[model samples]
Each structure stands twice: as C-alpha cells, then as structure tokens.
Target: MRRVLFAARSAVALHRLLDVVPVFAGDARIARCFTLVPGSDFGVDALAVVDALGGRVVPWEEACAGAYDLVVSASPKGELALLSGPHVLLPHGAGFSKTIRAEGSADSASGLDPVYLRRAPIALHAMAHPDQVARLRAAGTGAASRARVVGDPTLDRLLASRPLRDRYRAALGTGSRRLLVLTSTWGPESLLHRRPDLPAELAAELPYDEYQLALVVHPNEHSRLGAYDLAERLAPAFDAGLVLAAPREEWAAVLVAADALVTDHGSTALYFAGSAADDRPVVGVGSGGPELIPGSPMDELLRSVPVLGRGQEIRRALDAYRPGAARHAAEAAFAFPGRALERLRAELYGLLGLTPAAATSPRLLPSPAPARRMPAAFDVHAGLIPDGVRVARHPVGLAPAGHHLAVEYGAAGEQVTLSAGVLYRRPLPSGAGWTSGGWTRHALDSYPGCRTAGVVQPCGDGVLRFRGRELPYAVRIEARVEADGRVSAVDPAVAVSAAHVWVAGHRDWDGGRVVFNCLVGEREFRVRLREATEGEAGAAV
Candidate 1:
C-alpha cells in the first residue's frame, strides 16, 4: 500500500483523469489520490466523480498536510516547498514556462550547483517533458541523469486506445480526410493574444471551413477575452469551420487524431510533438520563438499550420512531408526520454532510503587510475658539497680531454676566487689567529710544487690573463650543478655543454677533515689538509 499524492495548482480535469487511469493499469498500487484546486468552481462535479470512484477530494491547502510516500506536482517551487516526502516534478510541457521564472533567477544569482555542473547526479529534472529534458541537458546539467523519453503518461492514455479517435470524429461529424486543427485561445497576458494586428494576420493566411479547425479555449482564456471573443466572433473571417470541445480530454484525443495542428507557443505543441510520433502531422504557430522542425510526427503537424504571415516560408518548406527522413528525426527527437526517466528515478530514490542499483560491475564507474610519483632527489651515488668553499672567480678554458673546470683558490677565512690556470697548494695564507709557525706555511706550500704558481685572472673583457698572456674566455660556467655531478657551461655563446667539477676540501676547516678530487696533470688527486691555531695548533706543529 504505497501512498502517492498528485498535486496541481490548477487543471483539475487532467489530474482527475490521471488518478483514475492507474487503477485499470493494475501494476501501480494507489493507496490514495488527491487534487488541489485553488479558486472557486473547484469543479465539484469532478470531485463527485473522484468520490464515486473511491478517492478523496480536498482543498489545496488541506491536502498538503497529510503524509505520503510520493508527492508529484506540476508547480516546481510550490510543490517542492509543500511536499515533505519523495517528490516528482512533472514539468508541464517542454518549452519555457513559469518554472523558468523561479529556477532561472536562482540559477542566475547563485551560479549552477557544482554537483549539477560536474556529475549531474541523475536528479533535479528526471520525469520532465522530453524537450525540457533536452533543454536541461543543454544547460550542462548532465543529460545522462536528468531525463527519459518514457512517453508521458498523460499522452500515453491517448496512445493506449484507438477508439477515442472515432468517437471524437463522430462527435464532430467530420469526414476522415478533414484535417482537425485545434487552436488554443490565447489569454490577454499571452504575448500572441494581445497584439491587435495578429488576428487580422491570422485571418489572411487561414480561411475557415476550407479545412476543419477546432478552436479550444483554455479555461483561463474564457475570462481573459474581455469584449472580443476571438474564436467565436472572428470565426467568419478565418473561414469558420470551427468546432469547440468543452471537455479537455476530448480535445486532446482530437489532437491525437488530427492531421495537423496550429497554435502559439504553449504546452500543447510539446505534448503533441512528444505523443503523436506515429500520427499524421501536427503544426504549431509561434511568434518567432524556438520552432520545432518537421521531423517527428508532431513536428509534422506543427510545421503544417502557418503562423499567419510570419512563418509562411517555413510552412512552404514543410509542404512536402518526407516520411523517409522521420526515422533519424524520431531518434534525435526521442532520445531524451529514457535518460529523463532515469534522472527522475534517481532523484526520487535519493529522497527515499532506496539505493540505486550499483553500476553493472565496478568497471562501469572505475576508480581514478593512480598517478605516477617521481623518485626522491638525493640518491646514493650523489656526493655532498663541503661547507666552506666559496667559488668566487673563474676563467673559461678547455681541459686536457676537452672538458672545462673553474680553478678555485681560497685561504682559511677568505672568499675563494676561481680562475682558469691556477692551482692551490699548501701554506694557505699567513693568518696570525689560525696558523702556528712559519714552518706550517712551508709544509702547506710544499704540498703542490709549482702547480700553485700561475693563478688566472679576468681582464674585464671576456679573456683570462695567466703569466701576462691573454686566453679567450670561450666557456661559461652555470651557477648550479646537476644532480649527476655535472656542471652546465656554454662556449662562445653557441655550444652548450656540462662538465664534471669538484668543490674544495680541507681538514680542521670546520673541525672535520675535508677532501676533494682535483684534476692534477692527466689524473685526479685527492687533497687533504688541517688548519691550526697559535695556542693548541702550535703544539701540533
């Protein structure tokens, strides 16, 4: 016993009809059915029919209070606020409607919901009309979740029975060849109805009685016409073969049977276009709004009726109906139905405790593939630099094997200057605070022979001077070293190369013994030394 409440602000007849049909269908369990009518003329007769059929009828405000499993409604804002349970929003027809005013403004102000922008989680607009589904998907609210083309249940009723067609034709006393064109009377607030020249324009293109026209007035249109009864009074001008249907269901059935249709922008076009896919034709007249081309059966009908003078060219183009092209057109037009329904179901189920069936295997929604991570910076083969060597100045030169190294020189506490032709030897610098005896300097001096003689210096230009001879500064040493023990250098601003270089090392240079490789002659040699102070350093000397 699942309780479902069908709510609407108006349109009592449609809601009443929907409530009764499900009982005969048998698959759907209906614990309770309700309709909420706002104003006077609550259509007591319709309420009587509902009561006679074993359903309860109540005013709009009172009906909203009761608990229900699912509450479905046509008004998006009102119903969303009133219903305290799983809700289904059956948007009335496809084209832009009042809900646009409500949701459109909110969307404009707050920006789209991120869930809708990215995943579009199969909610929001699930059970909407077909075209509405397309519009929602186009707005980037993922189509995979929002709409399905299950065929509207309201129009489904018309498709379920064929006898209704004969009944409608018999009631009108029209021949089978007679084209039934139902025109809904536009209200004063309707943009099409208020224009004074539109009636005259409509009359010029449409000559009544030449083709059967059934003019239907929406219930609101009756009070809105004021002194001018556009359908009845102007019938003669447009060739008055006009037949009126007081009952709305009969009018819908007539639309189903009709060869073609003509109306301003309204839900009728959406309904006809959606449900009458197998029918003859349906044409809609719009004042230059979004026009549905003649592809689907309903689009054929909509394309047939010219909108007075405005869409005459479009009508001419649609004159020859192509049955062969309808297959592709039908697919393109009807693809949204299943997606819409799935979206609706997901949204509704999300409101309840029911979890959606997990996607067919985990592969359908696979976890994000793992990202590759880079290896750490300092690996085993990498050497660490000694703390004190400051490479201050150097000349550019090619080494013995065409490699290049910046010859660096330094004393205990002074900045190290590197040049191209210099070799640093012992007896580092005579500093009073650190070294003990003059013999200590002599021992340091003797360590490297005459290799310490020619210290290289730059002469302001791009040249190095060694023993008073200028050598071209053909190589450039980059400021940083690579992790692979290579230093980058450019020669003559053209060729770029990386070469092996080493930092200086010394003992007692910071209380720790330091050693570094230096290119000595053709082979590499490791130099080690210690710094001593006058007090404790003198004893070691």
Candidate 2:
C-alpha cells in the first residue's frame, strides 16, 4: 500500500485536507496519516483539529523518518524539506491574497514568496488560479516550475453547499429572520480586532426578531488566544445575542447562511462574494488599506465591494452590495469552480504513478447547528400596532434598559431583574409545564414584579398563566415571512417572545385581541392571541 502523509500546520490547512480526504474513500491501496507541523504560532491548535477529525496522527519525528509516496500539506511551512516524498502544497486560503514577510524578503504574496517557496523540495504547488503561478514565475521563484492549477477545494465545497443554504440557517437556529454574519480573519488587521465593539453594537442595533446576528472569528485567533480568553473577549457579544460560530464546521456554514455580510478584507468577504452570498448585501470596512497586495483578488474584492465608513449608519450601508458585486474578482481568484476534488485527485494519483479511480464521489459537507448559548435575558420593545403587537428583543447588557424585561428560568437571577415583568422557560417537560405550576409558582413567587409566567410545551406551543383571576392562555406562534410567494416557518422562541411581551404589560387586557407577529420556521400564519370564550375555558381564541 502506498503511504500518504497529510501535514497540517494550522486549522486552515487541516480544513483544506478535510476537503479532499473524502476523495480517497475505500481506496485500499493507500494508507493515510496526519502529522501536525509548525508555521504559525497557533500550530499547537492543529492538534485539536487532528483529534476532532480522528486523523491518524504520526509524531513529527516519526513522520519525518518515514518514506512516503505522496505527502500533502496545505502549507509549505515547517521543515517540508526533511520529509521524503513528492510534497504537494495547497493554498489553505482563497489563493495567495495575503501579504507575508519572510526571512530576507520584506513582503511577498504569501504562497508565492520565493524565500519560502524554493526552501523545500516541494514536488507540487497547488495553485487555485493560474494567476498565482504567474505571480510566482514573475517573482523568479525557481519552484514555480512545479506549480500546477489544481483549483480550490475549499471554495468548491462552499459553492457545492449552496443548495443547502436553508438547512444551514435552520441548523444555526435562524428562523425566518435574515442572517447577518460578521466575519474576520486573524491578526491586527482583522475586522474584529479593529472594531471589537461592532458585534455588540450591531446586535443591539438590529431587532432580534427581524434579524439574526452571528460572529465568525478566525480559528487562528481562537488558537492564538486560548478558548477561555477568546470567550472572555466575546462574552459581551454573547450576552448581547450575537451567535458565535464554533471553532470548526461552523464558519463556512455561517457564510452559507448569511443573507448579508459585514467584514474586513479577510478571505471570508472574498469567500462570501464567491459563494451563496454572491449577490447578497456585503458591507465592508477597509482594514486592509494599503496592507493587501494592490490589484490582487483580495484587494479587488475590497475595491469592488462597498466600504462601510467609520460612524456611518450600518443599516443603510447594508444595501451597499451592488449586483454582481465582487463576483468577477472572486472568480479571478478561483480557476475551476466545482471540480477541485477531481483535478486534485488526478494530480495526487499522477504523483504516485497510480491511475486515479473515478468511483469515489465527493460529498457536500453537512452543517450541523452550532452549539451556541442564546442570551438568557432580553430587553424587549413591544409596540401595540393595529390589532396586533410587534415585539423586538435585544439580549441584555447591550444597550440601556427600555420599558419591558423578560428572563428565562435557567439564568443566574439578577438583583435588578428581580422585578422582571415576564418570566419564562421553553420546551419544558409536561410535568413542569405552566399548567402543572411547580417551577412557575416558584419563579413568580421569587419575582414579585412578574404578573405572568409561561413555559413552552414540547409541541412548540406554550401556556401563559396570569397571577390574578385569569385563566392560563394557550400560546401559539405562526411564521408569516414569504419568499417567492412561499411562507417560512419560525422558531418556537418567536411566538414565546411575543407572548412574553403581551403579558409583560397586560396588553391583551387593554386590546381586544393581539396577533402575535413572529416566525415558526418557513410557513406563514398570522397567529391570534385572544381571550378564551365561556364555552372554551383556558383556550386562546
């Protein structure tokens, strides 16, 4: 059996390897193994990815000693010269759009820099675009002779996952709301670094029901700073209702789910432009001003896309995404659109002198819901409209307190929120439901300010009980969002939230009936919250 060594130096590299590993399924002739290498300071974090992938890891020393037929690494970093094999170096990112300072050279296009390129006996340089090779050749990099256009497997997977956009959104807990993603690459020039407060600000600024906000931080950042530290830095955003993408498997999925993107000149903005969000709203800030390679794909992306200036109203700039915006530049950065796996598999088999089999098919990556912690408390704005109530929620700790407050049962009880108007829990077991009244009584008893308490039943509907002489009202939610004349479904929280507002101020008593406007998933129905008739006791009319 021919041995293959997958050298991983960073999370980015490991993700690239993951893109192609499925191509070798059921190949009994090849034994695949992985070795974590060093390039960035975050090389140690690659071990976590290795563990997560169940990548059969050989120690660096053991990997160096072994003779392999083909060695693949997304980066040519960390002692590639010592590994005995026809080394294939793939660009972990969208081509060579970054600027790197190597030993001796001041700054060069990252992957093409001759100082790093010619240092190893690299058998192949996997170019995403033909222009990468041109840049490499122009720089007089002797290794350019071995460069080949194998396309971008990362982009291929992203593009392929476009059909699953709705599924991606559903996994992330996004119902009918438009998903707004804030993406950043690592380093000082990243969007998060420059505008650390943006997540909280935007989360506060947007109505929770109308829009869903998510943060996609680079894995390298999570690596550079430990998980705890990263968590500390983003805790405010979390408290303010910003859904954070998990370290792996989520960033790309978020991109796939994004309806609008707010980003720096990082690769994500470029990826968003090329992928599902090709025509979606993309609001950019030029943190890469004079930093990125001028006229490069990354630069062209920032140039072509609209720039959101400092102190500019963020909402208005959302429409800044022009039609066919950055699509050309993104296309230029990637050569073959959806065939990276095919071209790459052929290239690897050729290097091993083995005929590549076409039986194995590449699978589109599944985007599981990111295990995110939703805010425990929300500052609500419940406005009485004509025969209905429009409720918007912003997680607490973001902006100043408004009129109404809602608290979940599991939250650490707040002294100031001891008098909260709305107290609720969702999907509670049938025994502990509002009708059963153990936890609800305790919750209302603990908070004297709360006049009503509620709990969502397993059926996605809820029951709200009043403190005084009122029967428990059954809560039902309907999603009324439509696209192409087709309505969408909403999360249970939407109906529960609006119901919280109704009881928060006893709006149902003053008004005849209220239509709870919210989403349930993707289907549309205008839900009515009405008082129970004498014939139908405790039933919401």
| Residue 165 displacement in candidate 1 (angstroms) | 3.0
Residue-by-residue lDDT tens digits, candidate 2, 1-541:
8999988888777877877787677788889998888556777678777787677889989988999998888876677888888888888788477775433355676666677677678888888888888887898967778889977777777788888987887787786678998888876688877888777778777766667888888878877886677668878777666777766667877888888888787777777777764478777776575447777887877777677765236777886677776677788888887888888888888898988755554567578665766777777766645544566677776756755777776563676358567777764334332232444556667788886676654445665666763554556675443557655555455555566555555634753456654432223345666554433333221
Scored by TM-score, the top model is 2
Residue 533 in candidate 2, Cα distance off native in Å: 7.8
Task: Give the per-residue lDDT digits (tens) of candidate 1, residues 343-460.
Answer: 4445544554455443211001111112211111100111224422212111121011122222223331121122222332222335324222333233235433211122111211
Pairs with steric clashes in candidate 2: 487-522, 488-522, 488-523, 489-520, 489-521, 489-522, 489-523, 490-519, 490-520, 490-521
Candidate 1 TM-score to native: 0.45
How does each model score on lDDT? 0.37, 0.72
Give me the runs in candidate 1 sitting further than 4 Å from their true place. Answer: 12-29, 37-55, 95-125, 128-149, 162-164, 185-210, 218-239, 273-284, 288-307, 310-541
On lDDT, the leading prediction is 2
